[model samples]
Target: MDFRRTSTALTREQKLAVVSVADVKAQERITNSYEDALIGQYIEAAYDYLAGPDGWLGRCCLLEETFEAYIPNPGGGFELPIRPVVDLSSITGFEVSDGAGGYDPVSAALYAKSVNEGFGYILHSGQSSWPISIGVDPRRYKVTFKAGFGAADDVPSPIKLGIIMLASHFYQNREATFSDNRITAVSRQIEFGLRNLCGRYRISRDHS
Candidate 1:
């Protein structure tokens, strides 16, 4: 099984800020906007560190995003790589004829989607199974879908708070490491706190 993001045009607007600049300032107890720009950078950095497939959470947080999954000779059913699937756009099976690839769109009536825990699965609608591929193409089966928690407001409070905490930590500590050893302990504490808040939502690599 192979899974990859099909949509490459994710706009900055769609990558919604999990926490606002005002939110970060409030967390850090900043009175003025003297360093608002720097704080904003911290917010973006924090968001990047904790969101999407490459982030610590290994899951989309702010909004739904499209992804494509491929399965070779899928059986009765197969799991969707991304969790909490918002929608299943389409499913296609590849057919080989005379040493050429042909498209075979799986009809909606032949399959159904079910969410178990956070994982999404494409199951046969009735007792029937998925069509088998004729060749050795790895991309025999294709599934396109969108997955995410929804919008910024739909994101869990703990995740929002975690982003704020991380950004605040970045603001407080300008340098990666201070000469004083005490700051290291503080950084570790903050790291652990962020993990505790966002850990449960993190998707395990094994799931991928």
Candidate 2:
């Protein structure tokens, strides 16, 4: 299966920012608002670094987001690529009818989702199997779903704290490796602390 993000919390005001600008300011002990914009960028960068498929954790963060997963050929069911899936919006099976691509929506009654821990799996409701694709299309089946830990309040404290610390680090260090003509390494303590805080939530995947 392959996954692509279709929408994000940024699209909705209420779902934006797992950690706010004020949160980062407080973490860095900033008492003014002069660098609020830059701090906000760092906050977003920290979030991108720790969340999503390419993130360190390889998982969704707080707030709801939509993703689309494509399956070449489905069996009785398949796992949704993103973790902590909140809802399966729709599943559509693709076909080549009259030499043209066609999409048929699977009935909600014919399937169900099973969420355990943060993993999500879609299963056929009964003994039936999923419809087969007619051709060799790579994206034969499309699954749209919402995934995340939920609202800001539902996010774990460790993850939130980790973001704050990471953003603060970015705020203090403008360069990736050098400052004042001298090489600088990222703080090992902060790196280890982030790993410790987010390690349990990291998703290990063997597939591309």
Candidate 3:
């Protein structure tokens, strides 16, 4: 099984557009410069929650990273081919360790047909169990995979809407929500609206 660490595909400018912030020119001293900066932060926050680690809004991205599959239950056998993975698109590197401090690359053809759309990969080596030790450390079973919609431009509309709505709401209401002088909760209506829009993007193992 494989797990991954992903990077955000949205840029500050693209995020600003999502939240409907006024674009600032190179040397323009906009009156709401401070607000603009805050808007960027809010966008970051929205994206972080929506598409960060375990986030469900699977935006498309390039092959940015690969990670070791830290399988927690090697004793459980081959029940889990991919470990709590994000939206995996393709595998770039698949290597197994000999448990004697040597590594061998697994052929792509072996696992190519095992990828399911929403589920993770399946290992089919005509064997009942997967290799338990892919590395000397037993935790370095590794496969580099790609995931996301394809690129930032290809982010799903629902996800983009969620980011815009959340960022705008938070920016407009930041004062009361986080101000030292006037700490207050977000209104129920606003809370409900944001939840309805953004909560669907949350990844839940219980009901996913």
Say which candidate scores most in lDDT.
1
Looking at candidate 3, the ten consecutive residues that score lowest on lDDT are 59-68
Local distance difference test scores for all models: 0.71, 0.70, 0.50
- lDDT string, candidate 2, 39-97, tens digits: 88888888878877777777654566777787776667777777777544323222212
Model 1: weakest 10-residue lDDT segment is 90-99
Residue-level error in angstroms, candidate 3, position 101: 5.3
The regions of model 3 sitting more than 4 angstroms off are 1-34, 54-68, 72-89, 100-102, 107-113, 125-137, 176-187
lDDT tens per residue, model 1, 42-70 = 87888888877778887553466667777
**Any runs in candidate 2 off by more than 4 Å, and if so which?**
8-16, 87-99, 107-110, 178-185, 206-208
TM-score of each: 0.81, 0.80, 0.62
Candidate 2 TM-score over all chains jointly:
0.80
Question: Across residues 1-208, which tens digit of lDDT does each residue of candidate 3 receive?
Answer: 3455543454666555544454222213345565666667877776665663355444322122233344433332232232223443455555666566556775554443234443345355543445564324634455555554444555556667766666666666656665543444456655666567655544454335
For residue 54, model 3's alpha carbon misses the true position, in angstroms, by: 4.6
Whole-model lDDT, model 1: 0.71
Q: How many residue pairs clash in each candidate?
A: 0, 0, 6
Residue 98 accuracy (lDDT) in model 2: 29
Which stretches in model 1 have alpha-carbon errors above 4 Å?
8-16, 87-102, 125-129, 178-180
